[model samples]
Target chain A: MKTFFLSDGDLDEFVTNLIAKSPVFAPVAKKTRFVFNQLESVEDLRLDYDTTILPPKKLFVPTKQDLVTFEHGKYEECLAPGKKILFGVHPYDIKAISMMDWIHEESNFDIYYHSNRKATTIIGSNVQNHYKKAFFGSVCKELKVMGHDMFLTKIADGYLVEVLTKKGDDLLPDGNFTDVSKEQIKNAADVNTKADENCPSKLKNTSLEIKHKIRMYYDSDVWKKKSENCFSCGSCNIVCPTCYCFDIQDEWALEPTSGKRYRRWDACLTCEFSEVSVQGGSENFREERAERFRHRIMRKTSFLNDKLGGPACVGCGRCSGTCTADIADPVSIINEIMEK
Target chain B: MSCSSNHDKNIFLPKNAIIRKASQMTAFETHFTLKMEDESEFIYEPGQIVEAGLFGYGEIPLGLSSSPTQQGSFELVVREVGKVSKALCALKAGDTMTIRGPLGKGFPVSEFVGQDVLIVAGGIGLCPTRSMIRYIMDRRDEFKDFKLLFGARSPDELLFEDDLAYWRCSSDVNYLETVDKPNDRWKGNIGVITTLFEGIDHLDPATRVIICGPPIMYKFVIAQLAKYNISEHHIFVDLERRMKCGVGKCGHCQINDKYVCMDGPVFRYSDIKDLEEAI
Candidate 1:
């Protein structure tokens, strides 16, 4: 691993040259919110931002993708991982990506996710400003925020660029590099320490303890009360990085024989998520609103934890913030369950 | 882990298959005989399912009906309930479709090698169980006491009538069928499947009972099985769930910690007895 130093003035020139060379997706202002959009100019990048409205998951598994197409006696797959650099990703989002990797590769390999993940380069950045909904410090207390190819941390001089992989070393600037001093290392460490201390929200228990509670209270009536107001609106699932459920469909053009098959994002909170039976009276296992709500929590807190070695959630707060119903906060729900 | 590796296999891609024959079984049900494009074998167990559908519609999980002993092809009994299933029901001989599976855990048939096997099926649930019944009959010497108790909403709704007639006469199986609403011409027993269980004798705790039917039927059947002192471990249940990828990545088929598409569509009663979502 190698480290590089970039002063404020040097960073501007480097960012400008980098964008000119390849496409870059960095956090940019979406009015009041931030989004990871393609950079039109170096000035549009906002590494000092608080949080993005959607996690970087959309980059790997887009909301919609055309998988296979059949036309004129020919079958074609429109599959490719368009090369782009994802710069200024938060550490928690990287943890979510690691979980997604494990899921897609655990049994039947998802070429769609693997191809995009391989093509994109992730550059992680420390949380310079905290979001009010975030509680990463409470749940993932010991998480190091690894898995990024390169990491950027704010220092007194400028930015401390830590090359964490061979790809990171290859992506480094060609020339005009400066050696890192012990003082710069200390400044980088302080930035990371402040990131953790700045978290404003926290659950009543650690992720593992919460996992135990969720399993023990699988039949608790607390879920019924908390999910009372759920509107079945899936905004929480759309915004969360870990919500990877999808629905597949096919469409034909004016010509009946020619068509394409595609997949779109799906949410388990919907009534039909587990409804496989198309017989006379349909059999939807989680047909009730409260059951669907509990299923979501079960996945994050227990079902996935049993396999992923930790809670699937990284405390991104995307679900909590985007949920229109005030009852979607995992922290508040878990705390109520704990108290009961 | 860094994103430096690449994977080549696309599990979502389905294989081309041609329907050898398709005919209406009931008003809503259509039975199909399908073969791979190359006439390759569809070696699948009793409880395993394949994602099958016409290319222009979409795919849905359909449990295999034909036995693995029936080489070079397989059969499906699909009900016209949704877009994909309706399209499949409409497909006829020589029509093409896509298939992706031999997936999900199947019934533990080998474990029943020398044991008394009691099969209980209701409505269309007999489709998948038919695979095992055929397999067991083909190798009848390996098993003891084979009994099949089946019931349906009406006599007309009962599937695999050919197999039913054959089983009633053959020494290989002791079969009984009942119906909730029997027609005027009907002659067999008239009641729920559990009512037919009393006619079966020489049963003990070791009887390997397999049950498949509507979700509401399990409790009654399991309660009836308790009278014979059959342990939950000796009973197996086949289940179904909405499936997209057939590989378990889509998450629609998940029930608690188990991906029904992976861990099971078939499970021992003792294994999933506590899973509230599973019936």
Candidate 2:
């Protein structure tokens, strides 16, 4: 784990070089918010911003991905994107990606997700700014600088670049550098502590406790009351990094002999998400809006945690920020349940 | 069962299978016997399901209706319910379809040996249970007392009529049936499946009851079984859910924390009794 000091100009040069060789995705300003987009140049990279509109998960599991293409009876698995680099990811988003990795690996071994993950190089940056709604500080105590190829921490004049992997070593800038002394490490730690403290929201209970509380309140009227204004727009699911539920369909070309089978992101909040009609047109499951609401919360805090060993919600607060009905915030929801 | 083929190894990929025979069982249901293109045996347990479909249309999970003892081919009794099943019903003999299976946990027939077997099936729910019934019939000497109780909305909706008649005449097997609304030709019991259990003289404590039906039927059947003093551990149930990927990645088939595709399409009643979504 070698650390180097790079000037602001040197950091820009390194990003420019990396973009020149391969595709580089970094956060850029999108009106009032930020989004992860392909960096045409170093000018678009926004390392000083708060959280992006969507997590870096879209880089691996895109909204719609082709699983296979078929011609009559034969089919071939679709190829994933080539080698690319994702830059300026925050620690919480990195944790979400790791959770997705565990989920895709432990279950069916999703080759589509794994192939994209292998191709993409993750470069995480320390959060210099915090979103007003984000509660990662309270629930994400274990968040650290790991699961990334390189981690960049802001120092006085430039950036403290810590190359953490072999792929990271290749992206190192050829410039004058100094070993990160104990004092520099302490400074980085201080910055992280300050960032954590700056987070405005907090959860009163651990995720495990929240999970148990959810089971106790499984049939509570709180779900119906809280979700009364829900439009079922599913913005909460669309922006979630750990929401990996999808619907698979096959599309035929003009020639019926050839077609493509693909999967697109699906939301549990939607009315028809779990509707399966048997003979005589009778749907068997998940018919109520309140049940759907409870399902989304349970999936984030309890159901997925039971399977993946961690909460699916990373407390990034994108769902709450994007919710039109002023619901879908895990921190508020869990806090309300804990209060009861 | 040589397990050397690429399609057999990959959980996602479907192997090319041809329909060796096909017939309409009822107005809505069709029966098909499918064999791999290479003529390899599609080995599967009685309660497991297969992902079956055409290339243009997507796949859906269908419970395997044939016994494992039957080699070289497997059977599926598909009701023309949805898009995938409608397409499957349209196929005929020699028609090509893709299959990836047999997925999920099947019935534990080996553990039922020397025990009185009680089977309860309702409507098209009889499809998965037929495999188990056929398996038990093939190895009849291995098990002790056998009882089959079937219920349908009407005589028209009843499945496997020939097999039902055979079991009715077999001295070693006790077969009883009922319908919700009887017609002019109907002369048997006219009630729900639970009513068939009322006259039973004895429900052996060692009986392993396998039950399959729509969600509504489970409550009534399980309650009746409880009256007979059948312990939860001795009762096995096959649950049905909307499944996309039978290997468990797709979340469609999950019931609470359990993925029905992986943890089971079949589970011992005791194992899933506490799961609110299961029953």
Candidate 3:
């Protein structure tokens, strides 16, 4: 890993070059909130944004895409879209993408996620929107910085660029960046440290303790109480960067004989998530709202912890912000369980 | 169509198969025989499942009803339940559909070697059990006495009537049948499946048992089996869950941490006793 310093003007020029070279998608203004969209110019890149409405995972594993096409009796898989640059991703999203990479290829390989992930280059950055802290709590410090090709840290006079991968090295232009001084390097460390320290609500218990509490409270009334106010609108599931459940279906084309099987993001909170049709009736595994609420919590705090080596929740606080019922917040739910 | 989306690592992509035969088995169920378009051997064990569906309709997991010995083709007895199964049932010969896998853990027949084999199928439970019993019968000398206890709602719903008649006359298998409500033509045992256990109570501890039926049948069958000294691990069951991706990411078929697609559609009772959602 090599760290270099780029003055503010040079950094702007470097980013402008990147936009000119490839299709750069970066965070930009979207109404009152912010979102990752294709950059029209270097000026459209908003490094000082609190959070995006949707996590960058939507770019990697799209909301909807065709998986296979069927013509007559023949079935063939559709290749993923071409390569592009995923720019200005936050640290939490970087971890989310890495987790997506792990779960997709951990056991049974998912060619869709695999090829799409390979088709893009990720440029990560520390939170520059330091005015409002949107931290994931103490676990934020524990979230590993990985799965990024290149990373940027905003310093007082310039930006400290850390080229972590070969892709990052190849993307670096000839002149803008220079060797960093000791003080400039220390300032860069503080900026990254601030990103981890920016927690809104802290996790009182240790990671293991919280996981144990989640398992112990499986039969607890807390879930029922929490789910009572829930709307099941799937806002939480939709905002989550790591919720990868999906539904597959076939859509007909203009030609009667041709159709394509497509997959779209599925929300586990909905009745359609686990409904199975019986002889003439239907059966749903999680029929209760409490059970659905409990499932999402257990999945985040305990179920995937075994495989991903930590809680799946990145503490990005998007769920809490988006919930209309205001009960989808993990901070209160997790804290309440620990107290009980 | 491209090399990147090729079948090598594309686990979700299904194989093209033509419906060789799709005949009505009952009022609600249809028997479909599929021949892979390439005419390649479809290798699999009993108790394993295939994601069978047509293009316009989505796929559903159906247990293979025929023995793996029947290569270049396979059989599935699909009960017309949902949109997918209904579409499958309506399909006729020369009509096309798709199939993925032969997936999940299948019954371990080698472990039943030299042991008394008991297969209990209630109604459509016979679908997954058909291949197992047929495989065991093909090599009867490798095992001890074979017993099949089948119970359907009525005489009309009793499936595989031809196979039942053949087993009744064979000395290798002790075949028993019952119906919840008998008709004028029926003269066999008339009761639930648990009632037949009374006749075969003289069981050995080494006997291996497999139960497949509705969720309610498991409660009674397991209770009946518990009375004997048979090892709990010796009993196995096939459980179902909602699944879209057979590769475990869809998150629908999960009970606790166990992915029914990967961990099992067939799990030894002892191993899955702790999973609350699994019955």
Candidate 4:
């Protein structure tokens, strides 16, 4: 509920103190790309980085998680991790996390996801630099400035920190930040506006237009032709911030009486995602790659949007960035549809 | 960390139920009467399914075969096809199993009151419709012109022989059965389930037809129903999907935008006819 200014040295001290309080995760450079990892030192917090290889969603809904452990006839649930601070998340990713929160909350109320979400304090930052693949400017134009506990925006020689929640106010009691003037706040707002405009990639059609067109094009040749070069490796799904489809499995111990029931991230692009074995063993479902490909687009653009109030894709561009076959980009596909 | 309080809110936690009676119905099907540990009544409508499974094995969706009118205990007719169904078949009396539900949308029975009722069940599809048959029979005075047309692959595959005999002898109801192929000892009309419709002379437009069978049996049965001039909205069918979670969270049971677990397992033909993957 308050805005303050922090110098470079003061910001570093604030991060160091936050890390000491709890485990902090932030983006760090990994050779040629960036990744979200545990912040061991203040220097590893890449506030000015373009994008992370995988979105911070992994911390909330993990790639693999145990749902329940059973021994004999008794059952025990796997608890969520303790409280932690997720530092330096981008605006688009923060938006994606909010979408995931809504999804898990509205349907069946997934305690696993809700526990982790309640435990973590998100500290988001405005996009100071845009990646070559990112197209958030077109799809996610009106970004929320107040979803996280705190949002940091690069302004002049220092950072403008807007404390949004009560948790963020607790972090500021250490007296590491100075009171922000009206001019400084205005300057910070201008910087964010300019950064939004500077996104390298763009979508030709609006998100709503794309949503309506996707339903009509369910039987289109675009999916079959574009997915021709697809490897079905599920890299797009793995790298996506909003792809939350999972497969449930049971693993038994050697004793046969003890085992764990777990869920792991599963992709629609994979052949087995929609397969169900019936009598005499037959997979009688979405058996074609083209159907699976169309499913992914329909889910992101139309199905989820119709139910959840927004498109599932945040335009973070990780799917496009990670796809080796170069067929997973939503912008390119959407633009192709616009041309037709 | 402390997860005890959160575990209480976990929707996946299944209550323990004991099998009171287990009987082999057919070569591939086993019927079990399950009662909750506390001996409490599990109230549910006809056509609703329960997630039943063992501790070591995972859960599978099984339609309730017993009537909602039956208190304290319910029946499940499991076709021993998959791993979970096979495990359920091996379960005997006094064996413990976990159950979560009375989940999914069920048949609209209240709407069928005072209307001509036609029930078409083929093979194991009779399991779910058995609940409806029992419920309707219990309130037989409220309904009119009750007709049941059942078909099985052969004489050996017909489920609930005892119930069939009662329905055949009952003066108030009309029961017609046909087999795709008859055995040497078989004595009945032999053809697909649709052929049974030709025996009746008067076709009522107000008749509400409920059909459940293998996926392939739907189109033919629906085509025959059209000859009777029944509206699409008048015909109701129960669809089966891979329902991993009884709740809508799991995407497995989804057909397009509709989650079969939440939106329906029982839908009117008019409601889901446009959904290409639903049938």
- TM-scores of chain A, one for each prediction: 0.95, 0.95, 0.96, 0.96
Model 2 regions lying over 4 Å from their true place: A140-145, A173-178, B1-10
Candidate 4, DockQ score (0 to 1): 0.37
Task: Give the distance in Å from residue A159's predicted Cα in candidate 2 to where it truly belongs.
Answer: 1.8
**Model 4 chain A lowest lDDT segment of ten:** A138-147
Q: Residues A278-335, candidate 3, lDDT per residue (tens digit)?
A: 8768778788899888888888888888788788888788887888988887778888
Which 10-residue span in candidate 2 chain B carries the lowest summed lDDT?
Answer: B1-10
**Residues B241-279 of candidate 1: C-alpha lDDT, one tens digit per residue:** 786778888889888988888888889999999989898
Pairs that collide in candidate 2 are none
From the highest TM-score down, the ranking of the candidates is: 1, 2, 3, 4
Docking tier of model 1: it is medium
- List candidate 3 stretches off by more than 4 Å: A130-135, A140-143, B1-7
Colliding pairs, model 1: none
Query: Per-residue lDDT of A1-340 in model 1, one digit per residue for the tens?
Result: 6777778777777667668767889999999889999998889999988889988888888899888898764567768788888989988888888788788777777888878888888888889888778877677554456667988888876898888987677677633458998788878989888787678888878778888888788888877888888988888888888889999999998999899988899999988888865566687889888898999998888888766778878887888888887878888888888786
Each candidate's interface RMSD (Å, one decimal) is 3.3, 5.9, 5.7, 5.7
> What's model 3's lDDT at A115?
86
DockQ of the candidate models in sequence: 0.59, 0.42, 0.49, 0.37
Which stretches in model 4 have alpha-carbon errors above 4 Å?
A140-146, B1-8
Give TM-scores for every candidate, taking all chains together and pairing residue i with residue i. 0.96, 0.96, 0.95, 0.94
Error of 4 at B63 (Å): 1.4
**What's model 4's lDDT at A307?**
56
